[model samples]
Target: MHAFTVIRTYLRLGLLNFVQYRADFFLGVVNAAIQFAIQLLAISIVFNQTDSLKGWSRADLIVLVGVHAIVSGILGTVFSPSIGAFLESIRLGTFDFLLTKPVDAQLLASVQSVAPQSLTSLLAGIVIIVYGLQTGSGFPGFGSVVIFVGLLIAGLMMVYSFMMVLASLAFWFVKLDNIMNIFNTMFGNAGTWPITIFPGWLRVTLTFIIPIAFAVTIPAQALIGSLTLANALLTAALAVLFVAASRWFWLFAVKHYTGASA
Candidate 1:
């Protein structure tokens, strides 16, 4: 209850701040439009050259792209902004103030800032998904949609856990922003495409080592009604493992964190 109140308060304040910058909303919409165009064009060019990339058809690829956009929007709108602030606060020794508060530092840091502008990407993603489904297999059955939503939630949790793990590294590393750079690059380049095209080793790396598989591609599989039993089980198991590991690692990092006073 206390945590929910804090979150609600921060969210309200963030929205107030966001409304103060009306231009940002337009800019975000423009950027989302441009991104949607480029991504659609790239998919078009690929399908024009070949009817299918691996086993994924044109509509399948479009669904994948939509899932990518939705995931990207979520990361940008929520996780990335807070993680950035947490890292910066750690670097500037302002994390001391957070530790002094009664709330859990992790929760506080996770919701520290909000970027409402990135909701444009989520809207764009939804539009693309509707376009894809309508033009292809049509909307999924209720069970599939339910499963897809579950997978998407699990996938987002994994990504959040991974980002939290990375942010916690600020307790030790100096040039830590580069880690986010690598993640963004890989997500844009690799995650937007189906991971099945990659070689076996790279596929394993993306699935377990990096999380692109569970985050973007696997949920896509559910949406397209091709989610395998093995993949579904793996997604659930990995989500749990990632959350637990991230939590433990965060606690360890916080335990060892040296504040300005220390």
Candidate 2:
């Protein structure tokens, strides 16, 4: 209950901030629309060359793109913004204030900044997902829907863990903003497509090294009723492992930052 209240407070503050910049909100909406349009255009172009890419039908690919949009929206609205602020605070020596607070520093840093505007992408993603469902295989079974939601949550946790691990590097490399950029570049360029289409080695790289498959592709598979139980369990396990590891790394980085440990 206490944690919920704290999160609600942060969200309210973000809402207030968002209300103060209405124009930026509209601009963000426009930007999200344009981006989604481009993605659809690209998909059209690809389908023009072939009926289906690999084993993914057009509808399946659309769902994949929708999942990608939602993930990107969440990142932009919450994780990315807060991590950027956290990095800047570290550089400006302001992060010490967060450490002194009664709340968890990681929680505080993660939720301090929220881009409400980026939710446009989230809404667009939902619309796209619904369209895909209508045109593709119709609505999935209730069991499948449950599994899809669970996998989506697990995928989100994995992505958050990855971002947190990267952001924690700020303690050691204060000017490592570009590290996040590399992730953005990879996600923007390759995350929208199904990983199965990639070559064998590149598939392995995206799956393990960057883990985009777990973040976007696996969840899409869940929705399409193609996710194997073994792979779903593996993804869940990986999410748990990544979260634990990232938390440990964050503590270690904080200790190093505060000169408490070598």
> Each model's TM-score, in the order given?
0.97, 0.95
lDDT of 2 by residue, 13-114 (tens): 888999999888999989988998999889889989998898898888999999999998888888889889998998888898888888899998888898
Query: Quick one: best TM-score, which candidate?
Result: 1
Instruction: State residue 77's C-alpha deviation in candidate 2, in Å.
Output: 1.2
> Which residue pairs show collisions in model 2?
none
Clashing residue pair totals per candidate (backbone < 3 A) = 0, 0
lDDT of 1: 0.89
Best by lDDT: 1
Cα lDDT tens digits for candidate 1, 1-262: 3999888887788788889997998999999999888888998999889988998989988999999999999888878898999989988889999998999988999888889899889888888888888887788889988888899989999989998998899998845899888988988889888999999999989888789989889888888887998999889998999999999999999999988666
